[model samples]
Target: MASERILSKVAEEQKKHALNVAMATTAAAEAAVAAAQAAAEVVRLTGAAESCQRFRKFDPNLAAIRIQSAYRGHLVSPS
Candidate 1:
């Protein structure tokens, strides 16, 4: 019957539309995951850089203290 054929065509079109929607959804999810990973890497690297900066600041003070203590000891010791 012509009506049955029309119904079948409509069903096929609906299926194709559904498939397109599903594909688009999958692509969007993949893009979001990639963006999140990139953001996390940026945060990690920033934290590591901050930690290195803190250590650099601490190192100079520690070195100065060690040098001063050694100089003091040399001055106090008898030749």
Candidate 2:
């Protein structure tokens, strides 16, 4: 009687604790994934910036040349 009631109460408390722990674990995992994504983005941006700087060091006028060529082509193209 009384023991059964106590057992039922204990089971309910255990279930609540398990649920809270699971929720906390899920939140932590989500935070970790977000942090990883942010780190990856930082790395990607850094790589892009470095590549641009390297390209400029090698040939700074390459992009300007391409743009001029495109403009000349456009000018010659019949409209």
Top candidate on lDDT is: 2
| Model 1 poorest ten-residue lDDT run | 62-71
Q: Which residue pairs overlap in candidate 2's backbone?
A: none
lDDT of 2 by residue, 1-79 (tens): 9999999999999999999999999999976865665556556655655567877777767555555555555456664
Task: Put down candidate 1 lDDT per residue, 1-79, tens digits, no spaces.
Answer: 9999999999999999999999999999976865665556556655655566766565645434544555555456664
Q: Which stretches of candidate 1 lie over 4 Å from their true place?
A: 54-79
Using all chains and alpha carbons, the TM-scores for the candidates as numbered come to 0.62, 0.63
Where does candidate 1 clash, by residue pair?
Answer: none
Best by TM-score: 2
